[model samples]
Target: MKSLLFHRLALSKDKKGVLELSEQGQEIQKADDILKDPYVLEFLNIPESYQFLESELEEKLISNLQHFLLELGKGFTFEKRQYRISISGKHFFVDLVFYHRILKCFVLIDLKGGEVTHQDVGQMNLYLNYFKKEVNTEGDNEPIGIVLGAAKDHVLVEYATESISNQLFISKYQLYLPDKKQLENELNKLLDDEHDNSASR
Candidate 1:
């Protein structure tokens, strides 16, 4: 009886080890597949997608707000939309503004309906500058800016920041959520035969 119990214990250990190794193998395969994906590779270098502006974002604002946050990448929270800021006897409105707890800085966003221009970038920078000067607390970091538009010229964006010292970002906004076809394709690619077999059991 003692020998039988020891044998059973050894078998259980071996089974657990095999299960762990299998899980590790699956993870590695998934990582490799993600790396080979064209969209994933492109996003790894630049997480923001440029193809989003074709959708009617402003018209569907309330309906697509959650999807919009997901597409904005990580560490972004929706604070307020159409935020009001008053300065110099004029009222200025920022389209969207978020406070990043980790960065401890206010993120100012401006929504544009067409191709992003130098003027747009300059205006965003000005907003950041103003917030940093007026609203930033002693513990807060410098404010950041994101110019969300229909399209952005990378070179022009860089040129627009030639003199600005604040951390500025440019991203395109999409009105619609990812289509069913693309979502299905990604799901199919992510799910493998092994996953199906496991589910069958």
Candidate 2:
């Protein structure tokens, strides 16, 4: 009876082994199929939307700007916003100032509600120049400036940066998240066209 029981257990294990392996293989195949789909790939790659100052009150926006900077990625640490600086006996406030550890200097950011203008970039450059001259340490690199706005004109931005010696960057801010399906569809169309061209070649 003991030998018969042992034999039965062995047979049961042998019978289910192939079935379990087959199920695992099927799961792997499904995962691979999902990964190979262009829509899925594009959805995974889309960046998260950034929050803008205009969307919230000034006090709240100042408080939350640190999180916003992290979402911007790269090396950034929130130093102060609406930071006060005095030049030639007049006082000025800088919006969204940060210190970049990697860049080893202060980063001054200006927020714009409407279209970015040359004046906006100029103000940022002025802040950078002042900070570099007054606040920067001897070992610190030159301060950099960034102007983020609702809408930016590329030509205007290019013109603004032409004569500036300081490191400057301009980026557009989005209040709402991107549409996943729309982004996916665009990526899929581009991928399909590329595949077709490669096949023809």
Best TM-score goes to which candidate? Answer: 2
Off by over 4 Å in 2: 1-58, 192-201
- Of candidate 2, the 10-residue stretch with the lowest lDDT total is 31-40
lDDT of each residue in 114-159, candidate 1, tens digit only: 7889988887877887898888889978877877775678799788
Pairs clashing in candidate 2? none
Q: After superposition, how far is residue 140 of candidate 1 from its true place, in Å?
A: 1.5
Kindly report which residue pairs in candidate 1 clash with one another. Answer: none
- lDDT for model 2 comes to 0.60
TM-score, prediction 1: 0.57
Count backbone clashes in candidate 1.
Answer: 0
Which candidate ranks first by lDDT, i.e. highest? 2
Task: Put down candidate 2 lDDT per residue, 1-201, tens digits, no spaces.
Answer: 311222222223242543453345323221111111001111122233534344342354555554455344446687886899898899988877777766577778676766789988888888888988889988888887777676778898899899888877776654433366755665566568669979999
TM-scores, each model vs. reference:
0.57, 0.64
lDDT of 1 at 78: 73
